[model samples]
Each structure stands twice: as C-alpha cells, then as structure tokens.
Target: MDIKQLQADIAAAVRGNDVLKCEVQNALDALSCATPKLKYLEIHVLKKDENINQFTNDLQECMKELGVLKGILPKVF
Candidate 1:
C-alpha cells in the first residue's frame, strides 16, 4: 500500500461530508481515531529506523500494520 495514498484516502474519507464552518470536524475525528496508533507506531519506528539494515524490513512491516490501522480508521471519521 502506498503511504501517500493511505494519507490521501484518510483525508478523503473524513471529508466524505462537509459541514459549513466545520470542515475540520471530520479531520478531528480522524485524528482521534489515529493519533493513539500513530503514537504507538512512532515509538517503534523511531527505534527501528535508526538501524541501517532494519529500515527496509521495518518499513514493510509498518506498512502492513498501517494497512490494518487504516482499515478500521476513516470509516468513523
């Protein structure tokens, strides 16, 4: 899965509907749904990204994880 696509899809999903003066409301809901997972992911990513040989594998794993996270996300946003 493309990380950029994931990001864009999330944006699209949340903005699925728009309310006057509340354009950010859906984004807020997306953040509420994703922030905790992002925090959890960032910790592991921080540690693994530092290792030269670990970058590729770690990234692939992260993508899989992110896919799962995304699956359950934005839907509620």
Candidate 2:
C-alpha cells in the first residue's frame, strides 16, 4: 500500500530468503561430508559379507570331511 510498508516487506522477504539459502548450503555441506562415510560403510559391509560366505564354505567342507571320516571309522556304542 504505502512505499515504506512495501519496502519493509521486501526487506523481510529478502532476509528470509537469505536464511533459507544458508540452511540449504549447510545441508549440502553436511551431505558432502557424509557421502564418503557412507561409501566406506558400504565397502565394510561387503567385506563382511564376503568373509561370511567364505566361512560358510569352509564349514561345509569340514562337515563333508567329518562325514567321510565317520563312514570310514567304526562307531562304538
């Protein structure tokens, strides 16, 4: 309505936009920091999965050997 009131409103809007921009920039910076950590976590999980698979294979082989040994040896009650 009045020029002074319009100027005040514009100033307030500008300040609000600046605050929002700062918050967006902060969020982007945080995401940048987290990206590498997330990648490292993914790699660590994959390695653990690989180890689990290897251990599972080893256990199966041991079980098979035990079965063979059992068949060759006589069982005493």
Over 1-77, each residue of candidate 1 has an lDDT whose tens digit, in order, gives 89999999988876774453376877788889999999999998887766855877789999999999999898878
Predict model 1's lDDT versus the native. 0.83
lDDT of each: 0.83, 0.97
Task: Give candidate 1's error at residue 4 in angstroms.
Answer: 47
Give a tens-digit lDDT track for model 2, residues 1-77.
99999999999999999999999999999999999999999999999999999999999999999999898787543
Question: Which residue pairs does candidate 2 place in steric collision?
Answer: none
Which candidate comes out best when scored by TM-score?
Answer: 2
Which candidate achieves the best lDDT against the true structure? 2
